[model samples]
Target: MNLAIALTAARYGAATANYTEVQRLLKGPDTGRVCGVRCRDVLTGKEFDVRAKCVINATGPFTDSVRKMDDQEVPNICQPSAGVHIVMPGYYSPDNMGLLDPATSDGRVIFFLPWEKMTIAGTTDSPTDVTSHPIPTEEDINFILSEVRNYLGPDVEVRRGDVLAAWSGIRPLVTNPDSKDTQSLSRNHVVTISDSGLVTIAGGKWTTYRAMARDTIDAAVREHNLQAGSCRTMGLQLEGAQDWSPTLYIRLVQDYGLESEVAQHLASTYGDKAFEVAKIAQVTGKRWPIVGKRLVSEFPYIEAEVVYGVREYARTAVDVISRRTRLAFLNVQAADEALPRIVDIMGKELSWCEQKKKEELETAKTFLYYEMGYKVKTDQLTDRSEISLVPSDIERYKKRFRMFDKDKKGFITILDVQRVLQSVSVQMDENTLHEILNEVDLNKNGQVELNEFLQLMSAIQKGRVSGSRLAVLMKRAEENLRRQAIPVDRSGGGL
Candidate 1:
């Protein structure tokens, strides 16, 4: 959806500076006229001034902040409300189904729906101070879980441990000076032209974005009597909308040697441009299996997407993981496990040095920990030190790999792999074990090395293992473990 918005802006010849911040508004000699803006690039720390016939202040929840820049005495028109959402395992909702509660116990709306193969339940509308990144509170998480359980069947349960990731967003609910709560405030968008000729648009939802933009642009045109054509976006196709189909993944599979899961992911994500991404994988220096390897073994996200995202203006690892792909949103653990490899690929693609790579990884981890509510163990480093990316599963896999390494070598044989599975109480059949060994033992050797074991196990920990019988058994086993009723961790950070 964000990509479509960006593409639509580009379609109209809009030159955007994504990370640029407005330091102040440029004013004309005459009072009550904004002529331009002085902006600073957040990423490069470069400052520049842009002169314009008219300036528009559409900063959403920060509308008042920008308005204050024009005139400090202006009253606040925006009442920002924070709405929190949490992602869980898919079983909470039916396949391709959604549940909406128009009025919850608190008389607020909440939705439990399937998104990106995971169940997303949200949201609680409450007054909040405006901020760029709002962390989801424990009370908000509990409220959602409790409300969702009220709507679910008796057989279905909403467990806190099932939450994969959670986030909070500020709703720019606009209104007068009266102290009405956000829920009581109407979400009707308002376009106001200040005395300084600054146009501010606020108080709209996703479904009303187009109307808000159209109205804002119409106001801009009328305010300056700017010559313009009528809006043509009503029939315009967004970027990647052309030449796309549900079956496009088939071509990727046939032409690029991509796994069906990976192909489908690419086709769904990039639309017609899936072919372009696949072409990169086809010609890259990496070998066949490695080139097409999944970032997280259980998920269909592949390394190629990282390079593709970087080229598409994904300046950070968090951008690639959270926005470009839904990995970080779907499963924080899986996203954490895949971080190093993603950073490595992105570093090479963006030409980042070792220090820059370290910075990127740390920044990504900080986002995951604070913004996404994933906890990290900050402690002393051992031979197996725990970084933000090294979740318990990785450490567990290392221990298991070492335990099964009969000769104390860095590698383990197929038999040892079977023993490790058995130790986990996962009873995979002989055929499935051999298939797993065949997939990860890239050299076609009869043994599975420690690194190969970690990759295989990490993939198995979360979701499906395509083209392998282990998918069903592993899924069932994981579900059973999940049903054991682990105590909920209510402190900051996640379960």
Candidate 2:
């Protein structure tokens, strides 16, 4: 939605300064009327001034911070509530269907919806400290999972291992500073003008963004007594909505020889501009497989989108993964694995040096693990694996291990692992099979014993096993089967 707004605004002659921050507001020498803002480019540390007839502060959660620039004594208007969401396997919800529980166990609203080929179960609303990047706490995760289970049948199990990614966002709920209960605060937008002639907007959500903007612009025009025409954005079509159809992907598949999944994804995401992305893929795919190839086998997101995202003002790996694409939100591990290729492609396009590329990867990893809650393997993996295995889990592992141990030698060979993976419909090559053996073979015997298999399953179940071929294979197999049951192609991340 943000991209659509930016694209539409650009086409209509709106100039956007990306990665720029406002230093201070400029005023007239005599009348003290607000004139412009002193701005600094965050990327280069260069400062500049933007002269404008009207200045509107619509920084959402940071509304108070920007308002403070106008007057330090201004009271706060933003009461931010942290809302956390988690993405589970697609089978958790039916395709194109969503469930909304009006009241959770604690009287808050929770929803389970299908999103980007995965199930999105969210949102715990509680007063939180204001921060740019909010982390999803374990307690919130468990609360969501537990609450969601109340709506599902006994046969349908919700496991922590099925969670692909989790994220937290601050809801910019506006209220008087005296209001202590965040839940009771209305989501309606509030528009106000300071004595300094600075217009500010706070609260609201994605569903009412258009109305919020209309109200904001109307207030700005009214407050400044500026000459402007009536708003025509109500009937305005977004940048790519014109001349787009559901069957537009057929043209891409026919002309570019792209896969059905890839075609559908591009068509839905880029709308009429999908052809431009497809052309890049067709032209550059021969030179680099990563350009047209899928980032993960289970999803249809190709590498060309990274190149296209860069062209659309994406400056970092996080922008491409988290914002430009939904890879980071849908699947953190896949996003992490695809990071190097994204940086490599972005480096070539943006003229980044080797050091810049390294810094980008490191910064992106810090975000994925610290901000997004992606787990990394450490020395505690053994202890976590042991703790995750209970009597029932051990028994279940024993029964499954016996099926592969047909010879009853109390151990399974690499071929047995390959067979087990194949039984789950995971295609494995010889190299991957050896890598799996190396991870599970604790004694370096080139074979996995019953105890080793138990420990491996425990770690896999607990999602503590990282950088292991077996863990990735098992996860892929489970997720692929779940997605195959659904009909829609959600790899594009957004509609």
Candidate 3:
């Protein structure tokens, strides 16, 4: 829903993330008609001026950051709260159904929504300082996993390896501007015009995106006395949603020669304009990325979606994978395979230089690894500590990894990581989890499948792994056994 609104705004000539509003324009000293902003091309680092009757700062958690552009001393009105989500396999919830846990063990709301062939279970709320990138903590991960496990069926035991992805976002909570108690703060959205003639909008979720935009623009126009058009968004259908219907799903499959599941995925995501995207597959002879049965597909996203994202959307790798098609959120392994390809497709579409392509990859890497909280399991690493020198230790961790291979597929998955660690009694901080996982993931597949996890276990035991270096994971298994008051003799040895 939010994506459609953003795309619609872009259609009406709203320059996007490519240009940062550097400074504000002033007519006189104080009571002046607030003008447009000074835009700097992020790609080229070039600055230029533009005009607007009223400037609106709609940057959610970073509301103050942009407001500070107009006045450095501007105080933050938005109180940031960190929320983390865990993505589980689709089987956790039926494809057509979703699960919402109204409250968690911590007295907070958490939801397990069915999205992108995976169950997106989240949202841990903890008051946090505003940050551009929010990483999930070990306690955060453990809490979510433990809480989610409480709701899952008896047959379904979640493991860290079963978690395809983990992500955190900052909620732009409107504070009392005076008090700390949330009750004292207003639940309603606040649209305020700063002293420098900058209009600010904050404190809302997906449910409130439209109203937020409307209110912000309405306030801006009225305050500056600018003759702007009425909110057309009420009747303005997104590019893809126009004339959309369920029957179109079947028609799309028949017309485009696409699989049923593929058509359904497209129709639902892109709406009526799905045909436009589906057509690309036929023209390019691109293959539909079907992983297993028709129901269980890996890379449901196609080259067509990649091209559409670059051509129509922000044209960045992160936008393509993370937002446009949700490949990054859906499955990490598929996204890892598709990232280079998406970058290549975008590179060709955008006429990017070699250097530009490198820059895009670097930025996207930050989003995938750091922001999204997936440890990049790449082969290139200078960390010798992460290198395993012992076959026995590697074998031992492999056995433990099998426990997380809940489906017994010889591979570990998303929900497995923290679960197995904690079960073994190894717990570390959030930053440490990020560091260790990134280097330990040899394949950078996010999940520890095949021999990759075995390699990491051996490295940790050798006391070489940096983040995993802190509390030698070797203690987890032993500690758990001791806490249970059971003796675990190393001589007898256990997996």
Candidate 4:
């Protein structure tokens, strides 16, 4: 139904509409009822107006803001709850199926589901203040890991260093008049038309978005006496939903009902028409094994999927794996193994240069590092190997660094520094190198000269760097190398 609405809106050329930061709701209009929505495009700074007989505020946990727009006396309407998940290597468990832990250390239900090949275990319930971009703090991770370890065994260590990625999503649960615990708040939605006629839809999960939309629309239809037709969503199919096999199609149908096929496609690709993806994954002369499944092509399927994601779905590279596909949580190896192919395909499809491909790869890596809480092994170029360095190699490190200084400028970029560090069996923080240079660059010219670079590297290598001092040095080094006109010897890093 969500996809159906999106397709319908798209077919009608519904320009992308999002609330610019809401200015004060206009006063004394329509007998003090909310008359018009005033918003500015955060991107272009363009202001716009939308007049409605009834306005639906389905802004999730932030519904209270809409109440303020209505009359400022609506009271708090939502309680924020957080969900966190941790991604571990695929080989951690014997079975590919997911494991559900009914109890967590924090007394929440935890799910250890099989996501792709990787095992994704999560979730804690905690109250929080509403915010645009909410992040899971260190405490959240420790809590999740403690619970997960209880079930998986103490051997399942989740060090801050081991986390490839971690994320926190907010549940905009409806405030319960009788409930004491926020977790006890209803997952069901509430449709209330304020005195100002603003219809706010609060509370619900992804699985129940359709029902919420239907209820919200139905209320609007009756309240405004609009000429909109009866709900056709019950039978509508999403794009690309018709071609799947009966079993797969049935499963989709069960999940999405009348919009089964479309929902299947949309659920997989986030509402984009994925015909090109099917074409790319069609049985070819070559077949490659993926998580034991013999795929027609090794990774072109993933490559095509990524291409479709970026071009058709307005996805950033991070969005491609994090949301579009379960790659971030699935076989972490799969994503690492497919990176080259994905980048190559994206380069061809989007007409990107080598530099653009590198940038995208870097962005993807960053997302993996920080957003996904993935502890990417710097020593290994690919994620397929589970091996870690048993003994550090100081000589291999010096040689790698020597080679990475491509221009013989004596100064290395953060990429170079990262490569060398990884070669030496060291895993520096993602932002460490960049931060180091900032502190070491005494002239503030932004470039870390040979001496400054070496001094900073020595500090990091010697284990003397910490906190902001390390971050500044590392950051400055990366900045200096990235902006330098000189190019480094790519092959010296022992690729």
In terms of TM-score, which candidate is strongest? 2
lDDT of 4 by residue, 42-153 (tens): 7468887766555678788888886786676667868889877776655655565667777555468887765544566778788888876566676777777676666666
lDDT of 4 at 312: 51
Mind giving the per-residue lDDT tens digits that candidate 1 earns over 25-127?
A: 9998866589999999999999999999878888889999999999899888888999999998777778877988898999999998988778899999999
Better of 2 and 3 by TM-score: 2
**Model 4 residue 15 lDDT score:** 52
lDDT of each candidate versus the true structure: 0.77, 0.78, 0.68, 0.57
Better of 1 and 2 by lDDT: 2
Positional deviation of residue 154's Cα in model 3 after best superposition, in angstroms: 5.1
In model 4, which runs have C-alpha deviations exceeding 4 angstroms?
1-5, 8-15, 18-28, 93-97, 153-162, 176-184, 246-272, 278-301, 313-315, 328-369, 374-393, 400-495
Q: Which stretches of candidate 1 lie over 4 Å from their true place?
A: 152-157, 176-184, 282-291, 377-495
Task: Give all TM-scores, in the order shown.
Answer: 0.74, 0.77, 0.72, 0.61
> Model 3 over residues 1-495: C-alpha lDDT tens digits?
666766777888976564354654544455554576666776577888876666777778877777666776766677788889878788888888776777567688888778766788888888898876688876787788888888877866566666777888888888644455646444467887776677888787877667877887778778777777756556667767777897888887676677777778888888987877776663434464322112124555667777766666466788887877776676655565566767777889999998988888888887777766666544454444344445665566667787778676446654577777666655554445555566555544455665556555554444344465434544553454467775543332332
In angstroms, the error of model 4 at 80 is: 0.8
By lDDT, who's the top model here? 2
lDDT minimum window of 10 residues, candidate 4: 288-297
* Residue 26 in candidate 3, Cα distance off native in Å: 4.2
Candidate 2: which stretches are off by over 4 Å? Answer: 176-184, 282-291, 381-495
Write one digit per residue (lDDT tens) for candidate 2, span 1-495.
Answer: 798899899999999878888899888788676788999999999999998888999898999998888889998888899999999988889997899998788998999999887999998999998998899998898899999899899977566656688889999989744456643677888888888888888899999988988998888888888898656679788977897999998888788777888888888888999888887873434533323577767778887888898988999999988998888898887898889988999999999999999999999999998777675434333432343466766776678789988867567876776665555344535654455456665544445777777665554445336555556755553455456552222232210
- Superior by lDDT: candidate 2 or candidate 4: 2
lDDT of 4 at 185: 70
